[model samples]
Target: MGNMDISLKEMMAIDGAVGAAVVDYNSGMALGVVGGSKDLDLQVAAAGNTEVVRAKMRTMESLGIKDGIEDILITLTNQYHLIRPVSGRGGKGLFLYLALDRNRANLALARHNLRGTEEKLEI
Candidate 1:
């Protein structure tokens, strides 16, 4: 079982990974993070992304969809941002935030890898 540290470490192993964080959407806080760029503050990114997650969740509720989120992907010109909520009961209210260079990363593979990582994550 992996905790926040272990999960964050695994996220850093993704290709072209610039940074990764374990964030609490309910509180807009990063419980753990690693390998962030100085130009892009991971803490701020994590907190801001919390709103994205919440908005999507709220929309889902409004639409009357009962299923949980698997992940959220935001693709930009140069970067790919991935937000994946933890699935287990132990990881309630938290998510994994990852950023990668679009040119250097494979989005599909990264998604698959992150899913694997989340499944084993203890926290």
Candidate 2:
């Protein structure tokens, strides 16, 4: 299994990746972060996205949907934000977040890579 640093490094290697982070949705804290410019503060994004995850979970509960979320995607004019909640035994309450440049990224491939990374991540 891979550690956070290795996972983040793998994520950054994805085409058009601008930023990546492993965050704990329960506390809105990032356990590890890599590649963020002034335009994209990964720490702030992590905190904000915690709410997104929480709201979705609550909504699903309220609606009585028993299925778990595999990933959440937010599209922007210039970027694609992908949030994947880690499903491994040691990864509960944690997520992998990746930001990609829209023009350069292959959404399907990026999603596939992110899922693979999540599966291999140790924490």
Candidate 3:
């Protein structure tokens, strides 16, 4: 398995990958990040998105569904924000957050690649 740096770098190489981050949901902090626009602060975005993840998890628990989240998608007018919680052993409490330009990205492929990255990412 690859470490955090290699996993995140590979994600950044995808087409339309404007930015990516490995964040700790429990703390709302970015453990590693790549690419960011002056208008888009990766850290701030990560912090805000942590709330989204938490809220969803809370809602799921309230429903009594035992399944875990595979991914969460937020589509905007111009961009797609993808939030995927890491799974498997020792992957709890972490997620891979990726932002893409909708016009340039293939969401299906990005989802596949992100799943691979999630398997490799170490913490």
Candidate with the greatest lDDT versus the true structure: 2
Note the clash tally of each candidate: 0, 0, 0
Clashing pairs in 3: none
Model 1 clashing residue pairs (backbone): none
RMSD of each: 1.5, 1.3, 1.5
Give TM-scores for every candidate, taking all chains together and pairing residue i with residue i.
0.95, 0.97, 0.96
lDDT of 2 at 24: 99
lDDT, residue 29, model 1: 95
Compose the digit string of candidate 1's lDDT tens values, residues 65-97.
Answer: 999999999999999999999878888898999
lDDT of each: 0.91, 0.96, 0.91
TM-score for candidate 1: 0.95
State the displacement of the C-alpha of residue 19, model 2, in Å, after optimal TM-score superposition.
Answer: 0.1
Give candidate 2 misplaced runs (Cα > 4 Å). Answer: none
Sorting all predicted structures by TM-score, with the top scorer first, yields 2, 3, 1
